[model samples]
Target: MKFKIPDRRRLLIAASLLLSSAAHADDAARAQAAVTDLGTQLRSALMARVKAEGPVAAINFCHDQAPTIAADVAQKHGLRIGRTGLRTRSPGNAPADWQRVVLADFETQAQAGSAPQTLRYSSSEGLPEGIALRYMQGIATEAPCLACHGQTLAEPVALAIKAHYPEDAATGFREGQLRGAFWVEVSSGN
Candidate 1:
């Protein structure tokens, strides 16, 4: 009877762990989806803003509205979402300590001819002694990004960017380069 009881308890524990793992995976997937949707929203908005207000205005839109949009999305999804870059146009775009490490790794991989669009990473990190899901997707520089971030910027656009971001370092990018990444972090309700 005693042996049977222990066996049953062990089975219950194993089942609980399996269920927990599944739930963690679901949460991670939700976080990734939220980040993708948020990135689309921000990119689309910036594109429209640039079309209506021009590349100059697009820079301003990024400086002014991008954070707000990210914050809103994060709040809605119950996750932390944002972008970070190797050479940040806005100092605000500077990656956190962990993100800096990832960005450098990404830069190295990209230099080795990895498809920037296909570059991504996800991991579960111990947080508060529990596990949390973290994800990052590379932002490849495309033709549309050149107006402000290209190898050569228009004189006026450069001036506007300088006026706005006195410490701007996010430029001199070529098409297909790694501009940065959109990241999402969500706590597993463990």
Candidate 2:
């Protein structure tokens, strides 16, 4: 089918929109990578510790080393990064308002058969308290994850968790269910 050539103004506006969209997409990809990389490093560390030491050591790593890893990654990436869950073990893992919305959407999507690794999130604004580019991906519970985040824990595991996190609520998750999300953010002006 033959089509009329677009007018100059219309063509300019279309180009602008396309470019904006592409830029946002690029930013989203970068954000996803940062969060994924950080999570990967932390998970590997925890898994190695679990295999070598045990659940108690893994729990301690989650309580200690994990935060250090997150902070280091955030510093390296120059972004705000963290993990949050609906039922959090550490108070630091509490979801912000925007994170709550994203987590709820993740739950709904997961219930409808969306795999956690396939979940994607990106927004240039709408952060809970500030303007930022936000990305979050759900974390599904896996076999290794169960050593610390399982539905039922061994007595020693429970004691270790209690000793570390007195108000832990980040358990009772079944394998393949959403354990939480890894999120990354940067100021919109960045």
Candidate 3:
């Protein structure tokens, strides 16, 4: 048996493809880490705030500090991470066009009997800087979230939410329902 020797150009192309695949995998892993860290930290901090002060105070924390915490976690993971939904409490948290499509898909999956927490989406897209890895993990509404996001909010909680987000639409969630998602975008050069 004789084996043909590959040309140098073919070998180079194969090597480049291999490297690109490896980079894509690395980006996905990093984005996953960022999502987990950001979600855990945000939930813990919001719970602590609600316990110490009340749900109203938790609203303030979400309004003022959640973005900062997300930024820190994204930096720690060398990516960009945040929260978004079909209905956002903060206008700034509204989903982008791609994210809206993902969120709607998540909701459809959930309605079709898939658990909300099991829903996730990821993709790669071209950007001016290069390729970007985008990931989103579903956030299921829990008992604690009811205080602020449930169908009926306490008067103070409602007022607090209104004060912070005049156009809030993130309420009306029930336990086990889809709340939103933690989204991450990983790009070249962090």
**Which model scores highest in lDDT?**
3
TM-score of each: 0.88, 0.88, 0.89
Q: Is candidate 1 or candidate 3 better by TM-score?
A: 3
What do the candidate models score in CA lDDT, each in turn? 0.84, 0.85, 0.86
The local lDDT score (0 to 100) that residue 146 gets in candidate 1 is: 91
Model 3 whole-model lDDT (C-alpha atoms)? 0.86
Candidate 2: minimum summed lDDT over ten consecutive residues — where? 124-133
- Clash pairs, model 2 backbone: none
For model 1, name the residue pairs that clash: none
Q: Residue 27 deviation, candidate 2, in Å? A: 1.0
Off by over 4 Å in 2: 1-12, 125-130
Better of 1 and 3 by lDDT: 3
* RMSD per model, one decimal: 3.1, 3.6, 3.0
Candidate 3: TM-score? 0.89
| Stretches > 4 Å off in candidate 3 | 1-10, 125-129
| Cα lDDT tens digits for candidate 1, 25-117 | 787787778878887998799899988989888877788898899999988898888988989877877898878888898999999999787
After superposition, the stretches of candidate 1 with alpha carbons farther than 4 Å from their true spots are 1-6, 9-13, 128-131
lDDT of candidate 1? 0.84
